[model samples]
Target: MAVIRVIYKEYIPSENLNSIVDTIWIATNYGKEIESRILPDGYVDIVFDLDKQKHLNSGNEIRISGMMTKFKKVISRKNSETLGIRFKTGQFNAISNIPLSKIKNTTINASDLFFKLNNSFLDELVEKKHHWEKVQIINKFLLAEINWSDLTPNKLEHSVCQSIQLNYRELDLNKIAKNHYISLRQLERRFKATIGVTMKEYHSIIRFNKVKDCIAKNPNLSLLNTAFDNGYFDHAHLSKEIKKMSGVNPSEL
Candidate 1:
């Protein structure tokens, strides 16, 4: 069986998060046994099944095998096959850069979106050539067809979230604001308004995500080394932030 591959991690900027939602991808070549217990955080997901059964906790454990697609708001599960994107809070704002207040909570058929992409889009991916080009094609197609205007708040939030995700680790907001010729306060306010979270909270999420990547890359890495490598002040501070966000000690994970 092929080992699960974590392609990449991104931090969505406040502007993009307001306009576009964040995405997570786990790809496998030969298929592998993958499971994880995800915590609740108010984001929704639309999952696409490849070959394995995708399960979720919604009353009874919902198992989807074969080619399938579905959507859900929240799930409470200790463990299950992990295949999907975890939309963060305020991430829905980017689903189509529309106002959140105007968007009535509704169900969207996942197959409608997935199938719209040419069968070649999926077929070509199986060969792993020019994958990014194909993804751009899919994204453009979806953006053009989705009703983005109806969710203004989410759209704006999505934009900001995507921007943060893209540049957070390398660029600080203060520098970003100075480069953009805006005051730090102005940037913060704009981010908060669009993303429904403070700049600090967003940064914390980015940092935590970075830590996860570091650990995955080097399982034997020391916590202090990992913390310093990722720009944290020290191990204690990193541990505190991780606990606050994930409700688990770093050592335990």
Candidate 2:
């Protein structure tokens, strides 16, 4: 095991890309190469290495990581920086050429998709030093990928996903389906297609994320308080759920 010092920065996407992209980020690993834990967030990403990529991967090609269903770890490459786009939930299907179902729990070369990544532009991305400049470069590519006519999200996806997030504690698929005038089976089918994970799985991740945020913001906060606050039945319930998502109990953190 080793410690990696990375200057990781995240920026809000511009208004145009905001609907599709959750954040534009830069990760620069300058010392003590460390491994990164990538958790399931029900979203996908496109990662570009700013410096010539080496140790962490076989080639310098741009890569796309699909929605992770569980935790995955990656070793940090020494003296490298990454510029990436974390797509918003349910939006990857619109921008990516690859099917969400095919990519679950794996990463593949962007060339695996229908569109050919421009080599000339990739050269430009490597030459840039400032993160803001890299963001603009990525934004241009994403803007072209957007389907201007299809600006709206799928109705069932929007409603069901919103309901899950809105009530992270009390996720009732039956109630949600009834409320939306769709059957549970229909919503499950749509959820699996629109997003890679099942509705129950996605809800669990969302709830765990909420608990993580709560703890991250208030380190001194008690586990019992954290559990109750995030709609868990009790500390024991929170512990079990956290372990499922992160492979560790809340006390460990």
Candidate 3:
């Protein structure tokens, strides 16, 4: 029998960045090499790696993983620690000036943007003995470096993002536009500019992510039931969408 590889993940809480950051997770993969599929959840992240041979040849420990449209396959080496910050949708812009669209599908060096920290920050973060200590360092760094100007919103963009996130699968774009009192075209443009994906795309991701979570957590969940609960037309429809988004069958996932 093959030994199952375990990837340990610990989520650290942060009251300071609660509004902008969704999760601060520290993970380490143990045992043999493993290929883990990362499903998109409509969020961007900043990852700091203690080991970086697979990330880039440039030897940069920090990189930003942008909003993803599809599942990303990541091969993890044994015994490597990774610390990451998952940002809430539309919140990245509140801290950085870079257009979300530019990095939509790629991971880039954090240095490309103007965000900065103490030179010893990464070293201090890695040397921490406990998970919460690292989270504290990160939270303080972000709170000190957060560019307040980016959080300002001019119109309904903030509310719109929240509305879609709250009602992703069942939301009617028409109704949202009406409630926001913006033309459909204007809504599309704003979503593209702020979210890097159109409103429809974001909603689709949310729906798929929900199902992915369900399937992973609920062993007794039937495919047909999962489809019905998530608003898919049927199992066939769910399977097709899953294939398009994750390039794998529902069973494989």
Candidate 4:
């Protein structure tokens, strides 16, 4: 099978930088073991598992569509390949326009929705459309299906997370707080409580995930070059963050 085209971007809320979400789009090919730990903010992932396995915590074997809103940690050891569309934050609602909290700890069959929306898109990709066009189509589909109502605006943190997804690269948390007329400390507290990780840790993970995508696409690429290109200060700093979260160095991977 051809390598899948995976598009990933890190977003910082223009108004609230501390509370941002990362959006990832995977097309065509199945994914590899994505070792991710739970952050302060929860996420809802939509995946299609081709190989059947029992639940990690609950030893039950079943094929189902599901949403995980709260998790301590997520580690995929083996046989965990799938087509994953994930939203990592309580600020973002389910891809099916549903509230994540409402569906937490439950599994629903999302095959219909998954196939309905993604099938045609993949077919078009097979037809050899430009990469930009593929991205545009995916964005259009996401915009149409995303239910904004599922998100309740309780605090500035929500605004920040939304802004990050809207503006992928250019994010400044302090500026976002000033814009919202709040102190930096206030923003930090909200982010930690709601998102589960400090602002720095969250941003580091976001940046690292972007680098991971690049490495996955071109395994032959140099790690030093990848770090520099993805906004890390240097290769050592990049290695530190990668090992911290992934338990493996970039070179080891």
| Top-TM-score candidate index | 2
| TM per candidate | 0.47, 0.87, 0.86, 0.45
Better candidate number, 2 or 3, judged by TM-score: 2
lDDT of 1 by residue, 1-253 (tens): 4545434333332343324445544333333344433432334444433322322212112111111111123332222222344455564444434332232223344444344433344344333444354344435544655565564444444555566677655547766677657788887777665544566666666667778678778889888998888878888988887776556787765
Q: What is the per-residue lDDT of model 3 for residues 1-253, given as tens digits with 9 covering 90 to 100?
A: 5564665675645676777888888777767678888777788998888554544443457888988888888766776678898887887876786778788778888877734632356668766888878888878777876776556753587788778878866879889999999898998887777777888888888888888888999858889999988889899999999998898999988
What TM-score should be assigned to candidate 4?
A: 0.45
lDDT of each: 0.49, 0.79, 0.79, 0.51
Model 2 backbone overlap count = 0
Clashing pairs in 2: none
Candidates 1 and 2 compared by TM-score, better number = 2
* Two-way lDDT contest, 1 vs 4, winner: 4
TM-score (C-alpha, index-matched) for candidate 2 = 0.87
Q: Compute the lDDT of residue 229 as modeled in candidate 1.
A: 82
> How large an RMSD does model 4 have?
10.3
What are the clash counts of all predictions, listed in order?
Answer: 50, 0, 0, 8
Question: Whose TM-score is higher: candidate 3's or candidate 4's?
Answer: 3
Q: Can you give the lDDT of residue 170 in candidate 2?
A: 87
Off by over 4 Å in 1: 1-91, 94-145, 148-171
Off by over 4 Å in 2: 1-4, 53-57, 118-121, 150-152, 218-222
